[model samples]
Target: MSVLDQKQTHKYSMKPESAPVFKNLSSDLPSGLVVFLVALPLCLGISLASGAPLLAGIIAGVVGGLVVSVLSGSQLSVSGPAAGLTVIVLNGIAKVETFQAFQLAVVLAGILQLVLGFLKAGIIGHYFPSGVIKGMLAAIGLTLILKQIPHFLGADKDFFGEMEFFQFDGRNTFSEMAYAFQHIEKGALIIGVLSLLLIMGWDNPRLKRFAFFKFVPSALIAVLVALGLNYFFKLNLPALTVGQEHLVQLPQMDTWQKLVNQLSLPDWRALQNPDVYILAVTIAIIASLETLLSVEAVDRIDPLKRVTPTNRELKAQGVGNFISGMLGGLPMTAVIVRSSANINAGGKTKASAFTHGVLLLFSVLFLSPFLNQIPLSALAAILLVVGFKLTKPSLYLNQFKLGWEQFIPFFVTVVAILFTDLLVGISIGLAIGVFFILKANYKTPYFFHTEKHKQGEVIRLQLSENVTFLNKASILLTLHHLPDNTEVIVDGSKSTFIDYDVLDAIQSFKVNAKERNIRVHLQDIPEVISTNAH
Candidate 1:
């Protein structure tokens, strides 16, 4: 089928009844397994960055996968605790003191999300300009590039937690790169380079066709290879070493009973702190925005071209977040990485997401020791690829072609995100984008399509639909430029709605007609208004 045909087929074929039950279930199970692998380290890493208990991340992943998958309206979208929210959560934890208090704020945030979903606030996502969304993706991509450099170079002193343009360490992403060259760890760099090469080689067309490697994920292969190299070559290269400090160090649980004992509850005392309220509100807004953005991104990539119910997504996410918080977990949202992995793994339903959660639970319970052995640098390599994908040069080129209106906002958003934090950068970019749109509309002629009549040189100027105060300047300019001794006919036939200010402007133009030796005429106007002359 042609691309257009495929798109239409995908779009029209998306009915719940039409979904292949058995086939989807089978495909999703394995797909979920893949997503589980991708999500595991990320969940732990993000949780650590957020200053929350490592178990909290696993709990959020499980809840997000299991609970949110069942409740969400999206078929292939995956939900989990996001690195995007780590900074916010970290700050929230610092302000709220005890982790229990932070849990209360998370619960409140969940409640707020639930309310937003019920109120159909997800519609807000629909209104975001396509340009701005593209820009956001680009900015996120740039951030990934900047932040991953230190990891690639084995520089851990500058914490991975920082996403701002300028760091507290008095360096930006670029400056860090400059510093990294001089103080590069040979072991980490070699391993990172080898991991990257292996990943790139796995994607080579000829190699991908090989039966043995075809089904294996490049990330898994890279990790295994790195581990083998670490063991065999005994490369004591400092840069190559996946530092113990950088790895996922799960809290030592002596037994299954001890693990269960680590579970926590929200502190009611946190509710008393005003900072908790602030943090809750911030979480609600940022989480909502991130979810909305991810939904959009996922939809773009979906082969089925299915449109997800945004409100239902919000409600599902709320429930997930609430449950996660109650169980001592970080905040959760529908993330693009695992979602894309699900699709790439041929996931066709929510079962994939649920299965991923199940797999995560199993890994945590049974494979904790093995998981801990996987180097942090190896996982960092995975994220490094993710980051590169987000900020690729192709994305920048694509945004530029979308026109200046889109490009400017997108560039600004990227720059803002690079310099500031995610929320602040997105806000600034969104504000600027909205302003440009309004300004563009303001410059458009309020009245269009003029025709001159021979009898009295009567010029009929037709007003377009939805005229507002912003069009006043255009209208006035047109009127003021009209030659003297001309008969002016104001036509409102096409105008469905006109603001009072526009009507006032028209009335003023009529009053001033005699002074310019112009005769005014009105056509297709409402009888009630036409009869009551100003």
Candidate 2:
């Protein structure tokens, strides 16, 4: 069947069904495996960054994959714990004073998300201007570049902290670069460079054409190589080796079992804490925004050009987040990293996403030791690539082509994100975007008329659709251009709505018409207003 036919069929079909056979299972499975590899490290890293238990991230990923896949309308999009939420999670943990308490807040956040979905707030995502969305993506790209540099350099102290243009470490990304230079770990630096090279080699056409290497993802290869070098060569690499300090070290089994056993209900005692409510609201908003943005982005890249049901997606995410939170997991959303990987891997249906969750669950249960062997630097190298893809030089060129309206917001968002946190940076960019939109609307011509008119000539001034106070200046300008004793007809039959300010402007113009020896006529105005006016 044709693509359109398939889409129509999918849209109209009521019950859930399996994906077609002959779909490339090999590609999807391998892609899922690669994503799993990439996601495992990110889950641990983001969880650590968020001050949450490492397992929480893993649990979020599994739930996102398993539960969300079945519930979501998106076919190829992958859901999981996101690095984007690290700042919010960190702040929430600090406020609650206990992980369990923070988790309670997460559950409440999920409930809020469900309410948002019920309210059909997902449609809000559709209203964001194309320019603004592009700007947001570009800004996120720039953030990746700034945030990943420290990790790439084996400087783990900052751990994805926002770096501003003027500061580094506590200052900005540039300052962090300076700090890294002063205290560079030679061992870490060497491994980082080597890992970068190995990752870069993965895309080489010659390597890709080789059958043996085709099945192995570059990230997996890089990690294996790093592990081998670390173990056999006795390389005294400082940050090169994934040390117990840097690696995800699960709590001791006894302690872990104790914590799990002691899982307490949401402290009803703290229900009155305004901070908890604030956090719950924040999580819902941020998670929803992120999910909507990811859905849009993934659809853009989807080979099938499938459009997901936004409301359904929100509901699915809400359900997943609620369940994940109840199970002591971090906040979950449709993350771009795994979604992109799924697309690249040729996922044809939601099954691939669901399968990925299953894999994650099994891996955690059975392959914890094997996972620990994967070098942190190797994963960092993968993120380095992901970060580069986000902030590519081509992105800048594309935005530049879109002109200043788009370029300004995109550049501002990037710079702001580099200096401040993601949410703050995006808020500033959005505010600026709104300003530009209003300014553009204000510049639109209010009145269209000829340059000159003979005395007593009948001239018609055409107003565009939806006349408002913003058009007053142009209307006045046109009227002032008319010759003395001209007969003017104000035409607004096409306009569906007229602002009170515009009506007042017209009334004022009418009162002054006799002074200029002009005779004015109105067209297509409501009879009630036209008859009442002199």
Candidate 3:
């Protein structure tokens, strides 16, 4: 490697340590600030999209960061209100007929997830094709870029956390961008452009040499600068001033009583409702799947390549959801966008996630008005940077070189996710991946070779370690196409178990072999007797 490459590698790589939570304070603190800035808007926006109380999203973020982080096996993953769950949450609330009922469902879902963890269902996560996982990351990056552009341009019509193609505003993803162009806020645009430039510049290697620049996260700086600029625009350039609609809209809790009032407890009475139980089952299954997928994706991107105990992560998520539901919060999973921001901003430990949660709690209590002053445009700019890094062109090239078996699924996943929703897209990708896997294995159940004999050449077919119904077609085809006057031996000596269907095929082949002047002999193969007797 070149000297510069070595330096760059050394700069980003850090040995995983079992130090105290606060030991990496310098890295974690700045990273926490960035994550807080990114997560704050998302938490509020996901709640808005879910048709839940705005405070519910914040509660999830706090529980995800504080509670989930503490119990999770992953060091870098940050959890919060995931966009993937918004549609479910929205429909769930409607089905249950009350937000309190939905909260009860969420509590029940948490219990289900805990059961799933104990049952070790998280093992399913390891089976995801690498192509599918990479596709998920790239698709999310593209989604972030596409979703954030309107926000960056000061169009606040769409909820900031929405990641679907079809949106709540009756507009698709691309159509919203078109709408954004017609109604750009000059102040937000300026702040966004400048913040984007500043954030990009801060990533420069030269900037790392300066203590102040290295220590402070650029995302936080971008937000504060955007706030100042908007204020300046209000005082001096009134035409360029950003409106309240384009700014962070954190719900105000001016006093302790107001804060307490926002906290809604789950209604135990909802337990009597059958729909609540159905919704609980739905939430548990979907939430656990999303969490498993997110952690797997996060592990793929970790600089350290650290593996998370998926079962432990599910348990952690279960506990987090329980607490969140009891406290009137939305259900959460390990969110990719926020976790990406945490990693990109130099987070070293789970402390950064915990810090972000603490910051969320403290901000809601004391800095609501202050946070409200920050423009959405600035946050969008930061996310844009994150999105670009994730879907870099090199990622596509690398995947392509791995061959069609890998690239097809990866490409399909990206497109599917863009046109549909997260879970649906992933499911489609997984199906495609499985198709390829099965196709490759269809004709590989046996080894075939030929040897010269006194009367003719003999064909020997050696069955694999285990032969099942999946290998039946290939075995039958080989037997049927055997050259006339050739002697063939079907060997199952190595097979520990052969499916009954395959054994029947071989028996049927033997009966017809003499008609084609072929001799067939079975070795260590069980014979299948015809059920019909004359």
Predicted model with the maximum lDDT: 3
lDDT of 1 by residue, 27-96 (tens): 6766677687678877776776688888888889999888998888777889998877888888889998
lDDT of 3 at 356: 96
- Candidate 2, residue 18: the lDDT equals 48
Off by over 4 Å in 1: 1-34, 158-162, 168-170, 207-212, 233-240, 252-256, 269-275, 337-349, 451-456, 468-473, 499-501, 504-522, 525-534
How much lDDT does each candidate structure score?
Answer: 0.76, 0.71, 0.87
Cα-based RMSD of candidate 3 = 6.0
lDDT of 3 by residue, 4-69 (tens): 334433433334344545688999999999999999999999999999999999999999989999
Worst 10 residues of 2 by lDDT: 160-169
RMSD after CA superposition, every candidate: 4.8, 4.6, 6.0
For each candidate, what TM-score against the reference? 0.85, 0.83, 0.90
**Model 2, which residues run further than 4 Å from truth?**
1-17, 20-22, 160-171, 206-215, 235-242, 248-265, 272-274, 341-349, 446-456, 465-485, 496-519, 526-534
lDDT for 7 (candidate 2): 60
Model 1 score (lDDT)? 0.76
lDDT of 2 at 115: 87
lDDT of 1 at 235: 57
